[model samples]
Target: MTHTAALALASGLGFGLSLIIAIGAQNAFLLRQGLLREHVLPVVAVCSVSDVILIAAGVGGLGSLLDAAPWLVDVMRIGGAVFLLVYAALAARRALRPSAMAAEEARSGTSLWPVVTTAMALTWLNPHVYLDTLVLLGSVAATHGDDRWWFGAGAMTGSIVWFTALGYGARLLRPVFARPVAWRVLDALIAVVMVAIAATLLHGL
Candidate 1:
């Protein structure tokens, strides 16, 4: 690999990580799933694959498409805000019921389809994901001359690495989340973060 290409790859990695490594609805959901050791692989796969698709689209000129239809962003933004707010309410309700937070029962009883659906919604429904992976990252990738694909590859790699680590590494915190109070706190935090993000999205719109 050329040194310049390597540099572009590194830059893309940094950019991707910086944008995603945040306290958001998707990360909160993934963390919860990880703690329960429930549907972790599917959730991670959904998120990672979604990012790969978004990044690829962006690099392949989704930016131009987006610009041609600015209302698309607004539609996504509204849809995302509604989903986040609804999820936040659900999380807050969970926080209120420590007994229902039954990690064991919840994990065993929950089916794969619901988790997969939520993961997809949290990923694809979030307008920020579109803006971040499509507009911002796409624009940046275009600036990399002949090495833009390398940059896109780096971003894709970053998404995979971060999601894999977050999903699997959360097991290390299992001991902590084993306590009902810990679950309550985590749920409360998730609720707050979701609402905050939703508010920001609405405010921007």
Candidate 2:
């Protein structure tokens, strides 16, 4: 790659990682799925791939359409809020009734579809994601001129690296999460955060 392209890629990687490396519904859900060590690959794939699409769309100028439509953002906001509230309830229940990963896998009856669905919902349903990936990232990428794609590629790399680390690396914490109390704590935190995020979304609407 050229020196300019390298810089653009590095900038994109940094920007992408900064935006996603925070506490949010998507990360929370992914973390939970990772801890369970169930469908980790698929979950990671969904998040990483979705991010790539969003970043690509953003860099490709889809941001203009998304920007032009206020109703679209509102629709996403409402849907995201509703989904978050429901997810919060589920997290709360899990906190109240904690169980080991083994038992959860055995009796949970949670097939791949639901897990994938939740991952998609947690990702695409979130309004911030659209704005961040499409508008914000797109605008920033535009500053790179012809090298903007390099920036987007860098950002996509960041997403893949982050999701992979988060999903696969979660197994490293298995010892800590082995205790039911640890799960209860994690789930409780997730519930509280999800509710707070949902409330923020509603208030913004």
Pick by lDDT: which candidate is best? Answer: 2
Q: At residue 30, what lDDT does model 1 achieve?
A: 90
lDDT (10s digit) by residue, model 1, range 151-177: 999999999999999999999999987
Runs in model 1 deviating more than 4 A are 103-108
For candidate 2, what is the TM-score?
A: 0.95
Q: lDDT of each structure?
A: 0.88, 0.91
lDDT of 2 by residue, 66-135 (tens): 7689888889999999999998998788788655434555654468988999899999999989989999
Total backbone collisions for each predicted model: 0, 0
Model 2, global lDDT: 0.91
TM-score of 1: 0.95
